[model samples]
Target chain A: DVKVTQSSRYLVKRTGEKVFLECVQDMDHENMFWYRQDPGLGLRLIYFSYDVKMKEKGDIPEGYSVSREKKERFSLILESASTNQTSMYLCASTLRGGQGPKEQYFGPGTRLTVT
Target chain B: DQQVKQNSPSLSVQEGRISILNCDYTNSMFDYFLWYKKYPAEGPTFLISISSIKDKNEDGRFTVFLNKSAKHLSLHIVPSQPGDSAVYFCAAMTSGSARQLTFGSGTQLTVLP
Candidate 1:
């Protein structure tokens, strides 16, 4: 089974504070993604890395950045956390050319609260 | 601006009955569709999917139906159990270089005994 682990399950941060959320995949997937799940907004992609040092912005990437120094780890950084940024964050990984929808495996998730 | 939409926010169904979840999309370019099931405090898991060439796909009690002409899709779960209760998300992706998916808000299903 593919195991995707997040650095923290729950986190609390103050406004204007820098926050880092880490994700690691044991399957060595080539694609890693960060998404924010919000009510009435589903899962919107924040950023994705196809390979080490390669990143692409998704639908809502503002105020967020990503780092992929290694293939197994992906990190999401909040430049300055704000109340509006409080939400559940999810990390997912998938093989590059796998069959059938390239199904993504995800970590448990990190619920971030920005006060 | 929401390409994929699941209008129903919640649904309640009796156990051992059918639970049908609906999804709609505005983009004709989307060629692939997927459904994901999410539990509390967990990320969404891949449930089922259908390609543009096929209309229906079934796995065990979970079946997915797609209507290309209507730009709509539906998931049918027969004899839904209490354990099946969760938030279901509908997602779509166009056939292109980037496989960034567009997802619906999601529908929460509650199965009552």
Candidate 2:
């Protein structure tokens, strides 16, 4: 079974602080994604990396950035945390072979609270 | 506007009954659809998916139906159990290089035992 591990299950941060959420995938998939899940908004992509040191912004990537120093790990960085950024963060990975829609595996998710 | 929408917020079904979850999308460019089941404090898991080339895909007790003409899709769970209670999200992706996915708000389904 493939395992996507998130470093923190729960985190609390103050406004204007820098926050980092780390995700690691044991499957060594080529595609990695970061998404924020909120009630009534579902999951919106923040950033994604197809390979190490390569990053691309998704629909909602305004105040967030990503770092992928290694193929197995991806990190989401909140430049300045705000109350609005408080939400559940999810990390996902997928195999590179499929054309359009392939299977996507996800991590346990990190619930971040900004005060 | 929300590209992917699950109008029904919640649905309740008794044990052994059938539960249907619905979703809609406005983009004609969307060629792929997927359903994900999520439990409290957990991430959404890949339930099933179907491409526009096919209308229906079934696995065990779960089935997903897609209607391209109406731009709608539905997921049916027969013999619903209490363990099946969770939030279901419908997602769509355009057929392009990026394959970026757009997700619905989600519908919460509760199976009463």
Candidate 3:
């Protein structure tokens, strides 16, 4: 079975604090992504990595950063956590060499609360 | 601007009936559409998908229909079950462009027995 696991199921951080959320996948997928889910906003991509040490900013990358130093691990960093950053963070992975639509497998998600 | 939109925020249907969820996209570059089902405290899971080249794709009790001209897609669940109730999101992606998916706000579906 394919599995994507997050570092934490729930997290609480203070404003202006630096926070990191980690994700690991056993599928050996070449692409990984980070998204934040909010009510009425669905899921907004924050960052993605298609290869180790390569990162690309997504639609909502402000105040967020990502690291992909290893193939199986991806980490999302909040430069300075703010209340507005409180949301459910999701990590997803998909195989690289696919012609048609590729399916993304997601982790259970990390619910972060910033105070 | 939301490239994909699920206008209906919620939908209620009776068990054993069909449930149709609609989605619309504004980007003409999109070549693929996908639907995901998400439960509370869990990440969304891939439900069904349709390629731009095809109009309809079916898998078991789920079928996805795509209309290229209208840039619209719909997912139909036959004989909806209680376990089928969840928030469904519609997503679209452009070919050869980072493979990043643009998602909709999502529609909460309820299957009442």
Candidate 4:
């Protein structure tokens, strides 16, 4: 079975501190995404990368940045953590070929709390 | 505006009854719809999917129906069981090459015996 591994399942950070959440997929999928999920709002994409070193901004890209240095790993970074940014973060990967291969596999989310 | 919407935040059903989960979308360009089931801490998993070309798709006890005219889709679970309780999310993707999916706010389903 394909596995998507997250660096941390729970993270606690101080306000204004920088935080990094790492994700690695073993299936060699070319597309990787980062999203933040809140109570009422659903999973909102922060950023996504279709290929190594190529990234695109999603709807909610205001406070988050992402890195995809290698094909298997994608990382989400919070420049300055804030209280409002405290939420569950998820990483997903999909096979990169074309439209029909767009099935996404998600990682166990990381819940972050900014104090 | 939310591109996709799941109006019901929660739904309760008897264990042996059918549970219907509904979802609507405002985007006309969306051509593919998918349903995902999520447990408490684990990430959402893909349960079933239907392309815009087909109105209905079934996998075992789960069936997904799509209506393009109304811009709506629904998932029906037959003989709902306690183990089937979870949050369900409906997602849509347009026919473009990149294929980015837009998701609706999930609906929590509870099955009682």
Candidate 5:
């Protein structure tokens, strides 16, 4: 089974504080992604990394940044947490290319609250 | 503009009955569609998927039907149990697009006993 684990299930941070959310996948997938889920907005991609040390901005990458130092781990960083940045963050990984569909496996999710 | 749309915000169905969740997409380039189930405080899980070449794909009690001409798809769960109650999201992606998926605003499903 493919397992994706997040660093924190719930977190509370003060405004202007830096927040870091970690994710590790055991499946050794080459592609990793960060997404935030909001009410009525669904899941919007924040950032994605296709390989180590490579990152691409997603639709909602204004307030968030990502890091991929290693293949199996990806991290999301909030330079300065704000109330509007509080949301459920999710991490997912998938194989780069294969014969079948590229289905992403997601982590449990981290709920961050900026106070 | 929302590329994918789930018209129904919520759906209620009695146990042992069929529950249908609908989704529509505006992008004609999308060739792959997927359905995901998410519970409160948890990330979405892959449920089923269908390609543009095929109209339907089934896995156990969950079946996803795709209509390329209409740019629409539906997920059918027969005899839905209480455990099936969750938010269902429909996602679409084009092949060779770095595997980025465009998801719809999910539909909350409630299964009543």
Candidate 6:
């Protein structure tokens, strides 16, 4: 079974504080992604990394950044947490090469509350 | 602009009945569609997927139907049990787009006993 684990299940941060969310996948997938789920907004991609040290901005990358120093691990960083940034963050990974759709496996998720 | 849309914010169905959830997409480039189930405080899980080449795909009690001409799709859960209740999300992606999927606002499904 593919397993994706996140560093924390829940977190609370003050405004202007830096927050870091970590994710690790055991399946050795080449592609990793970060997404935030908000009420009525669904899941919006924040950032994605296809290779080590390579990252691309997603639709909602303005307040978030990502890091992929190694293949199996990915990290999401909030330069300064704000009230508007409080939402559930998710990490997903998928294999690189495939003819059809590559379904992404997601971590349990990190619920961050910015106060 | 929302490429994918799940218009129904919520749906309620009695147990042992069929629950149909609908989704629509505006992007013609999308050739693959998927459905995901998510619970409160948990990440969404892959439920089923259908390719554009085929109009229907089924797995046990779950069946996904795709209509390319209308740019629409629906998921049918037959004999839906209480356990099947969750937020269902519709997602789509083009084959050439680095496997990035565009997701729709989810529909909350409730199965009453």
- Indicate which candidate wins on lDDT: 6
Best of the two (2, 4) by lDDT: 2
Ranked candidates (lDDT, high to low): 6, 3, 5, 1, 2, 4
Query: Which segments of model 6 are wrong by more than 4 Å?
Result: none
Q: Give a tens-digit lDDT track for model 6, residues B1-113.
A: 99999999999999999999999999999999999999997889999999999999999999999999999999999989999989999999899777999999999999999
Question: What is the per-residue lDDT of model 5 for residues B1-113, given as tens digits with 9 covering 90 to 100?
Answer: 99999999999999999999999999999999999999998889999999999999999999999988898999999989999999999999999877999999999999999
TM-score on alpha carbons, each prediction: 0.97, 0.97, 0.98, 0.98, 0.98, 0.99
Question: What is candidate 4's lDDT per residue for B26-93, written digit by digit as tens?
Answer: 98888889999989899999999999889999999999999999999999999899999999999998
Tens-digit lDDT track for model 2 on A1-115?
8899999999999999999999999997988999999988899999988889999998899999999999999999999999999999999998665686976789999999999
lDDT of 3 by residue, A10-114 (tens): 999999999999999999999999999999999999999999999999999999989999999999999999999999999999988669878899999999999
Q: Please tell me which predicted candidate would have the highest TM-score against the true structure.
A: 6
What is the C-alpha DockQ of each candidate?
A: 0.71, 0.73, 0.83, 0.67, 0.77, 0.82
Kindly list the per-residue Cα lDDT of model 4 for residues A11-92, writing each as its tens digit. 9999999999999999988889998888778888889999999999999999889888999999999999999999999999
Q: Model 6 in CAPRI terms: which quality?
A: high
Show the colliding residue pairs in model 1. Answer: none
Give the per-residue lDDT of model 6 (tens digit) for A10-48: 999999999999999999899999999998989999999
Q: Candidate 4: lDDT over CA atoms?
A: 0.91
True contacts kept of each: 0.59, 0.69, 0.69, 0.44, 0.57, 0.63
Error of 4 at A50 (Å): 0.2
| Regions of candidate 1 where Cα sits further than 4 Å from its true position | none
For residues B18-60, write the lDDT of model 3, one tens digit per residue: 9999999999999999999999988899998888999999999
